[model samples]
Target: MFSLMYETPSSWVQDVEALGTLTLLSDHAHCELKAAATMQALVAKNPTCDSIVRTLPRFAMEELEHFEMVEALLRERGGKLAEQDTSPYADGLHKGSRANRKSLLLDRLILSHIIEARSAERFYLLSEHLQDRELAEFFGSLMPSESAHRIMFLRLAEGLFPAEDVQARTAELRQMEADLISNLPFEARIHSGPKQ
Candidate 1:
């Protein structure tokens, strides 16, 4: 189970229903692309970090594959990827991270872990509740991969930083993530809260 302070309200499914499946699918595709890019960026930023170098590229490829799958789903629904505003949830998390060089990598890893954990949680919710059987099964299939990515980032953080540091920072960021999820207006976006 994800170690978080918040759980998405079941009413979020109603928001998704209002937003439409195509819209959600399009948003999901973008999330996948962003996830892939984030992994590659981490690699670029910390090239000498052996664990990151060895692990993240494979994760990046997996994210790209997920992107393709979501895009295909979007197209099948006659929806192309939509141009959208930056995710306030993700942006808030990054902004909340420590900016100093010493802590940046650890912070990024923790943020990635938080994101993946939330994604896994939401995907599981959608997999169970969505009326579209195909979409439900697709989301269900992704839950394990998302959960794996979450654990990988956490392990990487703990390996690179002191356990105390990792735990404290993860706790801090988890609170921030929970607050963001609780406050952000729900749209079709995967990380949003229920519509006001």
Candidate 2:
């Protein structure tokens, strides 16, 4: 029942091709590791937050599996993983986040929802249009995982605090997330800005 902060534009499918399929696969591989790292980090930061501590490791493992899948595809396509440029898309969202410990956790939890929700939408778009059936199938397969993760984060948020409070904060964060997406310069990455 979760929603994306941003709806990927119709142009993004065509735009993905501009980056070349290899680049897309490589970026996807890198993103999976980043997702895992975030989960591990949350686990570390909130040792006393047993809810996060118990859940994040399992999610991290799932992300690693996704990374492996994308890495395999990248290698198969003659693409080698290399240094990726800093993502303005991520940096911009992070810059607006609150700094206090409690707020950080809440914001991060909500941010996870935003990230997965957006990823789910983009993967669906890519899955629909990717010419190769195998690649399309692979991306298509990720939607369920993305959907689960997105929902899990929101559930955790509600579990941690009052439902109404979480909803209020989520509304604030969601608007910020959408604005962040709409304003950034477009790129071919899955979480990049809206198409120009």
Candidate 3:
């Protein structure tokens, strides 16, 4: 987890429509990497938990593949991974245990789902803005997988917590995610280009 001290300007999104596909790829790769590590921890902590453990192997594998694919894309584009500071994007969503163990897991599960769901939504949005034919095609190809990731996380959350609790957690985490995305000072990325 990184600190939330860094912020990017939202206006940088102007160039995203052009570079948006690459941006989507970058975001997806980062998301999967973070997710895989987090899922590994969750599965290890709850080793005997069949549902959680069973899902992690697949998730981890997919994430690794996604990371490689993104790197390949970057290489093809004649670009390397820039040291983009990522603090604002990660904060707030993850609320650890506050004494009660159950609440902690619930919070973790909710945060994970929010991350995946938001990734799916953002990927879909970026896919719409992509211009390059190959990139556009790639983004389109990823939509179903991204949707599946969200569903898997949501189902995992539901399985681990009560229905009401799952609902409440989803609402809470979604708000947190929204706050992070909406309030961040827009920084220019491959997707978030310069403000027009």
Candidate 4:
């Protein structure tokens, strides 16, 4: 299975729904755009292979479209994309990634995978737990792509590195992510810290 690298806490669900930071939806819109940009940057900086150069533009476009859809969702709900701070959860993960230029590409790819997987998992939670029917439906629709992107990132990393190397790094990162989620204080932003 497709178990998440980390399980979101039950209380996080309860807190999000209760605190009414529906702007989390807005945060998601921003995240999709950021994801798209990340891919675009990777494609631009390292055009060594035609496969990514050709494919990443399409993927980036898809992510931008997702951002649009989420924006629409926010507008329909009488909300605007809230100005929020950067997600500590994601910052922590990125901070933990290898900073040396030699391995940076592989590290970035794996980090992107971890972030996408976490988003996919959170979207599933929103779909299952949110009170609004329309919003829940929308959230459910978004999960497949996030999951797909997670797998895509993994494949890209494997293509760049030995399978065993990728696997080991992925496991290390997954454990790091899980521990981070478990230990951090919760917040209302999308990809915020773990529920506490």
Top-TM-score candidate index = 1
TM-score leaderboard ranking = 1, 2, 4, 3
- Residue-wise C-alpha lDDT for candidate 2, range 1-196, written one tens digit per residue: 3475567675787777766878778778888899999999999998998889888899999999999989988898888886899977678778866632357788889888888888888788888877667887889999899889999999888888888878877887787878888887777677777666
- Minimum summed lDDT over a 10-residue window in model 4 is located at 95-104
Off by over 4 Å in 3: 1-14, 17-28, 95-102, 188-196
- Candidates in order, TM-scores: namely 0.95, 0.93, 0.78, 0.92
Q: All models: lDDT? A: 0.89, 0.82, 0.61, 0.80
Runs of candidate 2 exceeding 4 Å displacement? 99-102
lDDT per residue, candidate 3, 1-65, as tens digits?
11112232322323554444455455556656776788888888889889988887888788778
Model 2: pairs clashing at backbone N, Cα or C within 3 Å: none
Backbone clashes in model 1, listed as residue pairs:
none
Superposed by TM-score, candidate 1 places the C-alpha of residue 114 at a distance from the truth, in angstroms, of 0.1
Off by over 4 Å in 4: 1-3, 99-102
Ranking by lDDT: 1, 2, 4, 3
